[model samples]
Target: MIPPAFRDPVHDSQSAFRRLLKALSRPGTPVSLTGPAQPPAPMGGPLAAIALTLADADCPIWLDPALSTEPVRRYLHFHTNAPQIADPKAAAIALIGDAGRLPGLNEFHPGEAAYPDRSTTLILQLPALTGGPSVRLSGPGIETTASLAPRGLPGWFWQAWHENAARYPLGVDIFLTDDRIVIGLPRSTKVEAP
Candidate 1:
């Protein structure tokens, strides 16, 4: 059966949105989320909650191979009325189930200089938020610098992130999620590995 969406759609979505904003505003800091009632497989509560909170009829989503299952498709379509696009560049949001095998960050839309807000927002599902190689983050919203070690990302993830950040106001934003935690990595954040 298709799992339910938010219990109280209005309130739940509002709460989810607030948490998302908090995460993005303070990059690298983990935020808790009260996800959907019972999200489908491959998509745990945190990813499902972010999807529900951000995606809508006007936002087209791009699902990676791991999360492009029929059930996930149906659930998202039914609940959000958001269309799933095949081309990553055309999607407003990209849902990635496997961070270790993620496509090149540039494969997705990196908004043009004049319209940076049009860039894709990636929501990636990882095994855990820690236990991997740690990186230092410094940018707006951060007091000084924050350290993060999200497990399951590829070896070149940080390098790619640096490249993405170099583009200044023209790169994709990211939301990293595990079971119940989420952390944002806006393009403005600089990632340095030691």
Candidate 2:
């Protein structure tokens, strides 16, 4: 059977949305998401919560191969009414399950200078938020610097992220999630690998 989404659609979605915004505003800090029940396999609570909070009929979603299972697709479709697209660049939201084999950040749409908000928002479901080698993060929301140690990211991720951050308003924003927490990495954030 397909697992359920947020138990209380109205309240839960609203609460999740607030936490998502908090994550973004605090960049690199993990925020707790309390709403969603378990989604399908491989789709964790925080990732599912993000989809339920931000996706809608007008949103176009792209799922990486590892997360594009039939059950996951059906669950997202039934709850969000968001259409799934084959092209990552055309997606408003992209859910990535396997960070180790993630696509290059440049492959996704970096919204045009005229409308930066049109860029894709990525949700990466990682194995754990900690226990990996650390990278330094500093930018808008960060007072001085912060550390991120999300496991499973590709070796080239930090280099790619620097290039992404250099684009300013044109790059895609990302949310890193484990099972129950999410950390936002807006394009404005700077990531330095150690």
Candidate 3:
């Protein structure tokens, strides 16, 4: 059987949602998730916690092949009851297990002109939050600039991110996570090589 979800679903989900909001408001800053539910393999603490907090019956999810295992699927289904869709464009949130094999940013829905907020949000599982090549972040929420070094991403990630950012309101938001740490990179955040 799948492991139990948040001990206090109401309180835990509220707290987790607040943390995510803070992270997104302060791009590149780390946010720690607090909870007791340990998700199945390939789904780390932060990702699992995020799924529990944000996903629901209305939020359809798309899983990268590596994280599309039965256990992971079952766990999310049991806890969130969110539908898992095959088409990335139809997903409200996309969970990526291997950053190197991640699809292009434009491959997912960027939302339409009338409703840019409908774009998909990406949650990528990374090896670590630091010790890789740093990227300079600018734009909304940042006072001047911020630096981040999310390890395990492909070399072309920043270039792709640059392109994604150029789309202005029509772009996907990203959340990068290690085991327990989560860093947000909203569509408004600009990324550059440092």
lDDT, candidate 3, 1-194, per-residue tens: 88877888898889989999999999999999764556788788788888888899999999999899999999999888999999999999999999889988877999999999999999999999998899999999999999999899988889989998999889999999998889999999998877
Question: In candidate 1, what are the lDDT values of residues 1-194, reduced to their tens digit?
Answer: 78999999999999999999999999999999979868999899999999999999999999999999999999999999999999999999999999999999999999987899999999999999999999999999999999999999999899999999999899999999999999999999998975
lDDT against the true structure, per candidate, is 0.95, 0.92, 0.91
lDDT of 2: 0.92
- Angstrom error of the Cα, residue 137, model 2: value is 0.8
Ranking by lDDT: 1, 2, 3
Q: What is the lDDT of residue 133 in candidate 2?
A: 79
TM-score, model 2 to reference:
0.97
Model 2 weakest lDDT span, ten residues long: 33-42
Query: What count of clashes does model 1 give?
Result: 0
TM-score (C-alpha, index-matched) for candidate 3: 0.97
Higher-TM-score candidate among 1 and 3? 1
**Structural similarity to truth (TM-score) of each candidate:** 0.98, 0.97, 0.97
Please identify model 2 stretches exceeding 4 Å from their true place.
Answer: none
